[model samples]
Target chain A: MTFIDMLGAAERQNHSMLCVGLDPEPARFPGRLAGDASKIYDFCAAIVDATADLVIAFKPQIAYFAAHRAEDQLERLMAHMRRVAPQVPVILDAKRGDIGSTAEQYAIEAFERYGADAVTLSPFMGFDSVAPYLKYHGKGSFLLCRTSNPGGDDLQNQRLASVDGQPLLYEHIARLAQGPWNLNGQLGLVVGATYPAEIERVRAVAPTLPLLIPGVGAQGGDAAATVRAGWRPGAPIIVNSSRAIIYASSGDDFADAARREALRTRDVLQAARADSLRVATP
Target chain B: MTFIDMLGAAERQNHSMLCVGLDPEPARFPGRLAGDASKIYDFCAAIVDATADLVIAFKPQIAYFAAHRAEDQLERLMAHMRRVAPQVPVILDAKRGDIGSTAEQYAIEAFERYGADAVTLSPFMGFDSVAPYLKYHGKGSFLLCRTSNPGGDDLQNQRLASVDGQPLLYEHIARLAQGPWNLNGQLGLVVGATYPAEIERVRAVAPTLPLLIPGVGAQGGDAAATVRAGWRPGAPIIVNSSRAIIYASSGDDFADAARREALRTRDVLQAARADSLRVATP
Candidate 1:
């Protein structure tokens, strides 16, 4: 199935929009699993086994694995994802941006080598930089629109001249993204949950585009406001929470705590969906 | 020595600002070195040995090696660079960008793992994304400004609104880079030789910032115009030429051909330096 269809299926089967971020920092991992690739793999596998049914997707930030010289850690992580949760999507949160040829190699690395169902991309290099990845009909590409960090407004919010003489940066991206290059409909936008107004504005421009909303839990962003600003009638949205869910407990029962946190977030997401449906019906 | 001092020494020692790019494509390799990692290493080592004293530095585009899953290729490539020309700096052409935590990991991978003197970075994720790398006091970070590709103008040329209410995307990056964050003075900018006017504008904004000029030969960029635009009076500048130098010949004498092309480019850069000195004196 295509990425969109797979997302729809995952949303229905799991009954949640929560995307668990599997960003395993070596410094923060349980002491028992520290300093060994095999032990880290086991820890990640246990978490996947416990929470496969509670969320729509899993996002493994590539840098966390890449930081250590774990040669085959990425491949092993993808294998664990496929074995435990075949229906749920695995998004490789690698914000890669390069020229056309290099971008093609990165696409192969994310899709063929690691088997990511979707990958995040940096859109600063222009549309052609991302066009090669979007050519993959079965995979999805999430463009960085507004990030979650404190310095995100540095350049992303810079006002430029739109074709119609308005605020340019994100609107330019929105206009181009909604235009000809999205023929496969596998495009998504990354709008940080911290900026509710920007999320609403982005939604108004590209209402049909799926959004990957980050920065919800530990980042102090309100989940209710995010769902209210970002939710579409029946469109796809994946609300990701990383530190709050994964590191809920550093003890041996960490996996259990992760599952509990994931369940709580799922319940909240389901209630938000119900409220969004009510508003749409009214 | 720091990256700035090394650049100054290379320019003075070689009497040239040319930086030969080592972008080795497997298909373009010599007959004996076809499709093998060891042979590729030998070929690159031979080229470095032949051309080390003729140019300012060597730039190896990371994507070419990454494309072929040649196990331990990057390690071998760095080993070859160290052995062939210990004095010449190696600039890794990997345009990586991400969050602060993730960027730190990449910095470790590039400087610690690969032993590169400098690495290219994309500034799309904002300042925090690059701050981790800049923390390495002795290493160099080249932020992408105006690229040489055809579609680069799409975003890089967009007129952004500044606090002074002027056109300001590249200008904003220049102004922000001048603050305390760049204390080590190891920061540089990557502006394409194809956009000489933009290069001049960027230089006018940040006069002391070193510049890495790519797109010289095969990309049809004017070498003289770029030298005129960016050459400071007896200061550091690296003019990179990849395909034109590396693939100068597809025969058994490929390494020799590469050395010859590098020599020619080096001569042109020396002449430009001479002209800059004359202009300064007048």
Candidate 2:
């Protein structure tokens, strides 16, 4: 199935918008897995097993695995995710950006090597950097719009001198992803959940495109506000939570605790979606 | 020594502004090595050994290795560079950009794990993303400013609305790299060799910062113009040529041919520097 089709199917099947971000920290792994980089797959796989039905998608942050020379484990984890929870789409949170042939190689890494359903990318290098990923027909890619980080303001919030209107940099990125850049209907924008107003603005601009909204749990974004601002009847919002869910407990019940947190967050998001729909209909 | 110190020492020792970019594609590998992903280390090591003394820096694009799942090979190649040519610094051309702990993980992947002297990063996420790399004390990073790709104009060339003269996106990045963002003097800018006038403009804004200028060889960026626009007395410009030098031959004499290509390119860049200096002085 195409990535968007998978997202919609997973959302309907799971009845959730929660995307559990698998940003595994070996040092933070509980009990026997603590400080063991080799068990990255085991830790992440357990979380995936516990929360597969609870999440609309699974997001794995590449740096967390690569940092500990655990790419093989990541490959294994990706395989496990596909085998166990094929219904849920996996977004590789790589944020990779380059040009031409090099960008092609990265596309191979994310799609062929890791077998990710979608990959997150940085939009700094513009269309050519992004164009390479679009060549992979059914796969999806998200451009970093208004990120949750405070430093995101250093560029994303700046006003652009466009003849039509002086739109903010993120707004320009949103419009591009919504219009000219979405050639294959595989484009999406990563709007951080921390900025609900910005999320609203992006939703207005890119009404139909899916939004990967991170920063909900530990990053302190209000789940209800994020859903309220970003959700629409046809549009989708994949709200991500990494640390707060994965590290819900420091003891041996880490996987169980993660499941509990995932369940809670997923329900909260579902409730928010229902409230948003009710208000919109009224 | 610090990364900048290694850069200066290598530039003086080699009398070259040329940086040999190690972007190994197995399909493009020479003779018996062709189509063998396992020989990535052997292929890259041969190139590094051949042109070690002809370069100011050795840039190994991470995507090329990671695409083939040859990151372990990259680790070995990094060790090989240190063993064979300790004077020439290695820049892991990752172009990684993230925030918070994820950024720290990437820093670890580049600095501690790979043992790279420097890394390339995308400045799209702003300061917090770039900040983690700076915490590595002596290590250096080049932020993508005006890239060589045609799509670079999509955003990098856009005018930013400010109280002062409306600077293009790239100029704002240059100013930031020159000023507040460059904590510990460990930052540089990646301005494409294809855009000589843009390089000159960047140099004008950030007079003393090091510039990693890629795009010379196969990409058809003019070497002399690149050197003339970017080269200045103490402010080093690393002119990179990857495919042309590395794939100079498809025969048994590939390494020797690579050395010849690297030597020829090095001399061309050195001559350009001398001509630029002569013009400046006259």
Candidate 3:
């Protein structure tokens, strides 16, 4: 099945818009597992097993694995996720950007090697960097639009002088992802949850594209505000919470704590969706 | 030693500005080694051994390694380059971009794990994303300013509405890299060899910063024009050629052929530097 189909299925099956981000820092692992890079797969698998039924998707940040030379472990984790949670989509949060042949290599790494349902990309290199990922007809690619950081204003907020009208850089990215760049109709935008106002602006421009909203947890983005701004009737918003969910506890009950946090955040987003629908109907 | 110090030393030691990119594609591997992903380290090590003394730097494209699950081989190659050509700097061409903690993880992945002298990054997320890498003191970071791809014009060429004056997106990046954002005085810019005029414009904006100019051979960038536009007495320009050098032959003498190609390209860049100097003197 296509990534969008998997996303919609997981969203309905689990009744969630929440996406748990697995950014495993060995130093941050719980108790016995702490500082053991070899246990990366073990630590991440527990979190996946605990929260698999509570999230619309799972995002595994590549750096976390590569930093510890645990890429082989990541391969095993990818297989574990596939076996355990076949219904949920997996977004390999790589944010890779390159051109032509190199870009194709990255596409192969993300889709073919990792078997990811979708992947994230940086739009700094433009169309050709993005086009290669679209070739994997069923997979989805989320372009970094308005990221969840103070530094995002440095380039993303700058106004672009266009013949038609002056639109901010992020706005132009939104329009492109929602229009011409959505070649396989599986394109998405990564709008940080910290910027609810900008999230609303992006939704206004794109309308239908799935929005992978990060920063709702440890980054101080309000989960309710994110859903209010991004959620539409048929549209999807995979609101991600990394540290807030995965690192919810430092004790042996870490996986349980993670599940608790995921469930809480998911309910909060669902409540906001209902409120958003009510306000829109009125 | 600082990355800048190493770069200067390598340029003088090799007496060349050419950077041989190790973008190994197994399907294109020579004869007996053809379609064998396991030979990534072997193929790249041969090229490195052949051209180590003829070039200023060595760039290993990480995607090419990761695509074939050859990251372990890449690690071995990194060690091999350090041992065989310790004078030359290695640029991990990852083009990674993210914010805060995740960016920090990527920084560790590139610097500590890979032991690279420098790494390429997309500056779309701005200062915070770039800042983590600078914390490594002497290590260098090259921000994607004006990439060497046709799709680059989509975003890099657009004029940005700024308070001082309107500048293209790439110009803004150049100004930032050359000025405030270049913390620790170790930041550089990646400008394509294909757009010689843009290279000149970027050089004018950031006179002292090193420019990693890709697109030379296989991508159709003119070496002479690239040097004329980017090279200066104090600043260095790393002219990169990947396929044209590494895959110079499909025979048993592949390494020898790679060395010949590297020698030819290195001399062309060296000749251009003299021409540029003579023209400037008159």
lDDT of 3 by residue, B82-151 (tens): 9999999999999999878888988998998889999999999999999999999999999999986878
Cα misplacement distance, residue A257 of candidate 1 (Å): 1.8
Find the candidate with the highest DockQ and give its number.
2
Winner of 1 and 2 under lDDT: 2
- Using DockQ as the measure, name the better of candidate 1 and candidate 3: 3
> Could you list the chain B TM-scores for each candidate?
0.94, 0.99, 0.99
**Where in model 3 is the C-alpha error above 4 Å?**
none
In angstroms, how far off is B96's CA in candidate 3?
A: 0.5
Which model is ahead, 2 or 3, in terms of DockQ?
2
Steric collisions counted per model: 0, 0, 0
TM-score, per-candidate, Cα-based: 0.94, 0.99, 0.99
Per-candidate Cα lDDT values, in order, are: 0.80, 0.94, 0.94
Candidate 1: TM-score, chain B only: 0.94
Candidate 1 stretches with Cα past 4 Å from truth are B37-40, B179-181
